[model samples]
Each structure stands twice: as structure tokens, then as C-alpha cells.
Target: MGFIETFGIVFILEAADAMIKAADVELVGYENVASGYISVLVRGDVSACMAAVEAGVRAVENMGAKVYSSIVIPSPHPDLLKITQIYNIDNLLP
Candidate 1:
């Protein structure tokens, strides 16, 4: 699991896009915590997740936006998966 948070929808989108293109990963949807703060999530192997997060941060920085936070969890706990499932986009797809 991995995520990158930034201000504004555009910055988040750019981060997500760069993340997906940088590695083999699945988009886990996003979280909007209000006040224009948003986070984009992704899931993949440790190396891939790390690469994705790095790319995301770089992308946002290149756009002149600051990355609020970022993380790459190589082995997430089962409880964390429960929460992440809520943000999973598979349910939204047909």
C-alpha cells in the first residue's frame, strides 16, 4: 500500500497519474479530508509502491505543489486493509 497527499484536486490527480505510470500498481481510489487536502492511494509490491510514491511526490513538486505526506507500506496489517477497502474503486466499477 502507498499514498500521497497534496492540496487541490489537480495536484492529487497529477500525483496519481505519475504514480500509476511509474510502476505496476492498482489505484485504490482517494480520500478527501476537507480543507482542500486530498490523498491518492495505490497498492503493489514494496519496490513498486516505493517507486510509485517517489514518482508521485516528484510530479506534484514539479507542478509547484507541495506534497503534504507520502507513505509506502510493504506489509500492511489486516486491519488496515479493512479501512483501505472502503477506498477501493473495484466496488464502483461494473
Candidate 2:
């Protein structure tokens, strides 16, 4: 779990991961919650996690994926935590 923004700043997902990796971020885990939907789980500060999501979104968009909506999320969401815990994932890079 992490915090990305206190007020509101979005990075798109792909961009956030790229930027975080470039910054040498070592995430504890990353997981996808839904099928055919671009969502993931990672461990870091809320702000950094938010950036990762944005970075992912950017990468998808760069590959020509259409973005319909975007939103900032809270780190403690039960669904997200559940997915991360069940997967036993850790240290996401790229």
C-alpha cells in the first residue's frame, strides 16, 4: 500500500512505473485485479504508487490503448490489498 497524491495529481500508470523505476523504486509487490482492465497493485508511498499507476497508463496509451477514464486511488482499498495478499507478489520493476 502507498500514497501518491495528497490533493490530486495523476501520472497515468505506465508513466508512474517508468518514473518510479528510473528513480530506483523497489516495490514490495504488483498485482492486477481485473480481466481486460488495466489495474495493478504495488507497495510504496501513496504518491509513488499513484505515479506508478500513471506510468502504466502512459505505457498502455503509448502502445495505442484507449483511456476512457482516470482516477487517483487510496492505498488501503480492501480489494487491492486482497489481490496483493493472495498473489504473494513483491518488488515490481518495469
Candidate 3:
């Protein structure tokens, strides 16, 4: 699993696109935390997730977006998934 949080709609969209294209990851969920903060979640194999996260960060940085944070979890606990509502299902990109 992977997560990328950044500012600006354009940055988020471009970063998500780069992430999805860079690996076999699937979008799981997204959150708009207000005040121009946005978070995206993706799920896939460990390697793919890592690659996607790297791509997301690079894409956002290249676009001059204020990247807040990012993460890649090889095997997240099922309980954590439940709490975050980040299911294995693919979500449409916004």
C-alpha cells in the first residue's frame, strides 16, 4: 500500500497519474483534508507500491506542489485497512 499527500488539485491529479502509470498499483481511496491538503491511497504488491509512491512524490515535486508526506507499506495490517477504509478495490481517479 502507498499514500501520497500534497497540496493543489492539479498537483494531486498529475501525481496520481504518474503513480498509476509507473506501477501496477491500484487507487484505493482519496481524502481532501481541507486547507488545500489532499491524500491519496493505493494498493498493490510491495515493489509496485514503492515504485508508485516514488513516482507520486517525483511528479508532485516536478509540478512544484507542496508535498506534505508519503508512505509505502509492504503488508499493512488488515485492521489498519479497515480503519482507513482503504480496500483492495480500485477507485476511480478524481
Candidate 4:
């Protein structure tokens, strides 16, 4: 990759890392997908981690960086384990 591409990847990755740590979210790991984009995995209470993720997004937004798309919260990895054991029939059955 050229300098610009490398910098963009690093910048996004670093931003994601800093955001997670600053929000007190437990980061599982991350991989740089491309310039200004990365996939992040974090572990913690689902809702709590979500809140933290939201905080992280806000921080990025505060920086006035353009997000290519909306930030996403994945189904599992962090709080999926907890959700499975919640014992909520509404969630389980229908």
C-alpha cells in the first residue's frame, strides 16, 4: 500500500483502539480492513459494551471524520454468551 493508504489504515485502527480504551470497553482485538475502517471485537456486558461503543462512535464523530457507513453492533463475541443464558422466553421462543 502507498503512504496514504497505510496512514489511513493506521489512523482508523488507532482511532478504534483509542476509542475502545477510552470508553473503558474491553477490547478483544481488531483487524484493519482498509483506510479509515476496521473490525473491532470487544468483550463485556452487552448493554454496557454497547453504551461504550456508542461513546466511542461519538468520539469519532466529534473528530469530524466522515464515516463511510453506520457503525454496527455485532450479534456475538462480547455479550452473546450472556444473551444465550438470559432465560427470556420472549427472546427464545418468539
The lDDT per prediction is 0.87, 0.46, 0.81, 0.45
Q: lDDT of candidate 2 vs native?
A: 0.46
TM-score of 4: 0.49
> How do the predictions measure up, each by TM-score?
0.90, 0.47, 0.85, 0.49
- For candidate 4, the per-residue lDDT at 89 reads 24
The lDDT leader among the candidates is 1
Tens-digit per-residue lDDT, 1-94, candidate 1: 8989999999999999999999998887898989999999888888999999999999999999999899987877766655766864543221
lDDT of 4 by residue, 1-94 (tens): 0001112454455445655665555555554556545555444555656665555555555666544433434443444546433433233211
lDDT rank, highest first?
Answer: 1, 3, 2, 4
Using TM-score as the measure, the top candidate is 1
- After superposition on all C-alphas, the RMSD of every candidate to the true structure, in Å, is 3.6, 8.1, 4.2, 10.2
The 10-residue segment of model 1 with minimum total lDDT is 85-94
Report the lDDT tens digits of candidate 3 across residue range 1-94: 8899998778888878999999998877678879989888888888998999999999998877778999987767656745575444533221
TM-score of 2: 0.47
Flag regions of model 2 displaced more than 4 Å.
1-38, 67-72, 75-83, 89-94
**Which of the two, 1 or 3, has more lDDT?**
1
Error of 1 at 83 (Å): 1.6
Query: Which of candidates 1 and 3 is the stronger one according to TM-score?
Result: 1
Error of 2 at 13 (Å): 11
- The residue-level lDDT of candidate 3 at 28 comes to 75
lDDT of 2 by residue, 53-81 (tens): 56655665675655444454453555564
In each prediction, how many residue pairs overlap at the backbone (N, C-alpha, C within less than 3 A)?
0, 22, 0, 0
